[model samples]
Target chain A: MSQPVRASLWAGLYCPGLPLSAVWDHQPGIGPVAVHSHQRGQARIFQAGRIAAQHGVRAGMGLSQALALLPQLQSRPRNPAMEQRALEQIALAAYGHSHQVVLAPPDTVLLEIAGSQRLRGGLQPLLDQLVKTLRQQGFRVRCGTAVVPAAARLLARVGQHADSPERLQHTLDALPIDALGLAPGKQQAIIGCGLRRLGELVRMGAPERARRFGSALNAELDQLYGRQPTPLAGWQPPERYRQRLELPVPSERSEALLFAGNRALDHLGGWLEVRDRALTALHVTLEREDAGNPIALGLSLARPGFDRARLLEMLALKLDRIRLPAPVAALVLKAETTLEHRPPQADLWDGRNHGDAWPALLDRLRARLGEEALSGIAPQADHRPEHAWRWVPPGTTRVCTETRPRPTWLLPEPRPCQRADFRLEDGPERIEAGWWDGQDCRRDYWIARDGRNRRVWIFHEHEPRSGWFLHGLFC
Target chain B: MPEAQPLQHLLDQRSDLWRGRRRPQARCTGSGRAELDAWLPDGGWPCGRLVEILPACLGSGELDLLMPLLAEQTRQGQPVMLIAPPLVPCPQRLHRAGIALDRLVVVRAPDQALWAAEQSLKSGVCGSVLVWHPRGRVDARSIRRLQLAARESDAPAFVCYRRHQQPPPSLSALRLGLEPGPQLTLLRGDGPTRALHLGRANVIELAVRRRQSASAP
Candidate 1:
């Protein structure tokens, strides 16, 4: 079957792109700001003073000279990695809307809308929504729709200054060939031969041009004019291991980050639950500061299929331990290097279930009493109350040791002199462990009801004084 | 679809999530507390609802009624989670009744002032949820969100009513008051006695003693 043709739509989601950069420079409200690099990290002004043909001072003029023309100008060091990451985040957000979203090199993204029309009632509505939603996210984007990728990009870029196709076409015509991102050699070659405009370049025959300049020039021209097929790789499908989230804002608070991180961990953890694959390497990519300065950091899991909660906890721990020099612009989580699937699991049958859902019961106890307070008495090879009772983390399979059968209750401590507040329905069930340890203990445990009509199992531990202790309360 | 039973009838019966239907031979353990279990046809309180518990806000053993059942179920694979259980809990005591503790995850929420535990229930990770909410006036919307979250997960949830302000209108299947038990009879020494009084749907059971005093030989 022939694949359906996709008429693409592009909304420059980076609305107010320049304004954002300008505002970010002043964010810390630090000394008069500029966004240019310096050997001493000193800020400089852009387009200092030399006038350009378009009536504005050209960038890179001498700072001393530029000060005479635009005295208020400020500049700071450029950040590109931050820029790319932010764009990628925006791209990912865009991808959530349509499957065929692709990231373009140098802050560009493509969204194929051939099939997403019905999702918004029609193509125009979809584009409108795509624009509106992004705008609500604080982006000031100029959007343009066209069947051609180059045309769409050119339109969104230039649509700000003009509206008509002919006017927009002139804007594209005025752009130097360098805007194409090709080498300067090609730009010089094009201009050197008197070829000044894209329209003029398109007028030439491909075969004639190829005969002189080779097919690379002809191909680029065809690609630019949409003469030959101009196919875009819609958004790249993320690897099987990725964490996603939808929050009101990209927050920077520590607790908020953990909350968001917990969600991401939950997502990643759920996937881990179904498979044996363990996340060995993880990368948290953030695109918030500015895409040009995207932040990428990583953590290596100690073992495969690591506990997700533990992993998230580690991230929060790591985040807490490290100082964030700058405010976070955005966050992304990437888990890599999955290894052999060893699913750490509980036993098929624990000695404690007693034909009931006892494991679940204990969980409630822990949740209620507190994790520190919740414990199980694993019967050891001993009859002594202390030996019969061993504190074990609940996940361990209950082991039944063939010694004196452990009594259900022990005196919290064997206290002397009391035929106290416990009733015995039957004779005491005796137990004695720890003979080898020399701290021998003998106890008579009984299942008794208190005066209030509640059941409790208690025991008397024999000592030099022969005492009674309230060990455990039966639920 | 045939309406096999009314909603109340359905509540009177329990079925394994996997079977999709209840069988006559399915062995269901009634609460085993006699008259109280008889009041609940399913042999206990409603399975998929919240039981608001209110104590002295400082007293102990408020959970004496529900603790054992929780211990018994946790010994098996299905784990129960208490979202904001008030106490750190004494697991050694639970183990005495054959309850397993390793599977229990007690999340401390006392420190978190905002206390947004709603998301935990929505995630559907636990077999049962116990939320200890501090005293605050709440509206119907928050209550609905919590109820919807628990119902959606099919996880039985209990929101313990901690204070004595007017009970907020709720979709909770059961509402319980756990005050002091009845006066203790003077035995070995004179001391105050307390009992657990339980009420559900206007039906009341008062001062059920959790433990009897020692008998004089």
Candidate 2:
């Protein structure tokens, strides 16, 4: 029996102006901007914004030439590090759509979406959502889909789409020879050989093409046409999210700091969603103007989940309570610990149960009043009433062994009492234990009533100490 | 006649006005004690409302009065929070009272006790919230905030003030003064003040007596 094969679909995301957008996206409406690079001491424009391009500024133009065209042009040195980080962030967003995400650096992310197309309804909606997500992140993205990864990247670079092999062939044939991304000399050589369009060159026989042009060009053609498979390294997200954002102007107001903090938190939330993880602990550092030891605030959640609103609210609460020593110049958010996200199962009846909101409430309280303030109580097996209970983390439950009558409230330390102050009611329930742990206790406990008619737990020491002490209260 | 139309509309909107008819019943949870529930206007503890308990002294069976409700709430897998209790709550006693030890959250936030209580009450996740306020520390504004939060969530909140402190004027749905005889004086509620006996059984004595009886058999 013969089986049919499933064709794979690859979507390439191309960020045409990443070099300019990465630095200027946060500061829009600042007029035309261009990112330039120093090539052998001569600065050349690498990319230009739409307004700059409309003003006749093109890539490879000298900075002086672009300046002469538009005196109000804002030009910044190209930041390769920032561009790479932006590309990785785009890849993180793409990872949400497909698991097989390949990073094509200098600016493209290729996604294998054939396996997940059905799960996302269809290819068109998936591509639309992918573009919308990138756009919302303030990146200018163009998407192209094809059966071959190389063809998809090329199509995306030229702003075209080819969904099938035939469409890809049609699209590739109509392109000029420069679309091959060859060196200037090679492209001129191909054009001089009477091949102005790629269709003419592709129509030639493989051996003649290889003989005329070289094996590299022939191999490139084979990979683009899907005759040979293209193996690319897949991109893996980092385990932690640590990003610093500098404020445009240092300010003493906490609202400004919270605004910047929230932006970083949005990225962190997206990172967690794509990784299928929940953050349990976050450490944020406020960089001040005086360069003194930065103010560090750590937030720990009772339950791990990517709840952005709750996290932001807790951060706002912390910011409101803190008195900044100096104006903050930058904010750094770092989250290292995460757990695999296990979403709670919904109740069948749609009841108003805040089971999910419980942890968030605990988180908010702890964020304001520190972690030591919250605890749960559990019974210990010791016979001594004072040693019969211990504090545990909230929401922890354990099986408590049966015991004799104990007070509802146990004092931290037994207070000395006069024997005449209380009227005895219940007889003594002897408890003599804890001798093994160096703190030996021999006491006879009784339930009595104080003058106010309040039930009190009193004990009389028999060994090592002799006194009447009020130990607990019935209420 | 035109001026009287607006006046008539205002009168129609007033829910507390005496219409000389039976009003709609308020939602409540049974107080576990049948006699106490009978004396309450709602036939039980009011839900989603603040119930202020004023004790003559610490450990005047104030906590015992609510033990039954807390135990029932915990049994249903709902969380019960105790904010800044005057002393450590004995888990053995709570356990014997049929309360789930795991579902109990004890927060020692003495400074922000009312704040924590308000947050817990507003979160709607807790089954009940109990806050112990120092004498004369609570103000009318904070109590009003607590009352509003309690009204918004399903959790019942209990604010226990220290002994003999003058109760502040506030919007609490119910207020009771606890005395030495374990008696409850209805300071504020749907009805006027009345001394109601709270014949609460000491669970500790019951446990010890039951153990002895089982051993004898």
TM-score of chain A of each: 0.52, 0.76
Tens digit of per-residue lDDT, candidate 1, span A323-369: 56555655677777565865455446743322222322333233333
lDDT of 1 by residue, B1-217 (tens): 3575585467556543334354333223444245445443344544444545554432323454555556545754556655545443444444443445655555544433113345445545455566666556655666677777665554556666555545566655555544434111111111123232432211112212222211323
TM-scores for every predicted model: 0.48, 0.82
**iRMSD for each candidate structure, in the order shown:** 8.2, 1.2
Name the lDDT value of residue B116 in candidate 1.
30
lDDT at residue A161 of model 1 (Cα atoms): 31
All candidates: DockQ: 0.10, 0.69
Query: Candidate 1 docking category?
Result: incorrect
Q: What is each predicted model's overall lDDT from 0 to 1?
A: 0.51, 0.84
